[model samples]
Target: MITLDARKEKVGDLLRVSFQTQIKFFLSNTKTKAAKSVIYNYIDIFTKDVEIINLMKEYEAQTNKKLAITLPSEEVPSRDAWVNSSIIFDSRT
Candidate 1:
């Protein structure tokens, strides 16, 4: 189950692309080191994505121009913060 929090328009697009990559990772039977590396990379990308949105908002406010971005909600639910936020993945099934 994926709960996507509302994000800036451009940021949302990038997230969608990243989600596709994540799906690929899920389909593969990779484990441990490689999996952890991919997860870290995804986190890095997501952090940067939010940063870009924030910078754009600041620039728009300073310049008095409309950037046409859908900003995230003020009270973002923790469950929607990431793709696997509330999921439990167990290999010893």
Candidate 2:
């Protein structure tokens, strides 16, 4: 029998993005059926740099564990900072 144990490494702060999305769908039958329309809006995301960094710092201090940050790989081209940071991708990739 063999037992293996590996320690995790520390990571850096994550880069959060702020975005907005709006969607609308409609369906209608002009001859006999009624019409229906669905609208989904007011979807947005925002994160403050200072606040996020502060939170990350606090978490690291309390947990004493490495923080693994995540970022979108494609967005790297748009965000220069991601160029030097790890892409922290998931299985979806």
Pairs of residues clashing in candidate 1:
none
Instruction: Go through the candidates in order and give each one's C-alpha lDDT.
Output: 0.44, 0.28
Off by over 4 Å in 2: 1-44, 73-93
* Weakest ten-residue segment in model 2 by summed lDDT: 35-44
Candidate 1 yields a Cα-based lDDT of 0.44
Q: Which whole-number lDDT from 0 to 100 does residue 70 have in model 1?
A: 44
Alpha carbon lDDT of residue 46, candidate 2?
A: 25
Cα RMSD for candidates in order: 15.3, 20.0
- Candidate 1 segments exceeding 4 Å error: 1-8, 19-23, 48-93
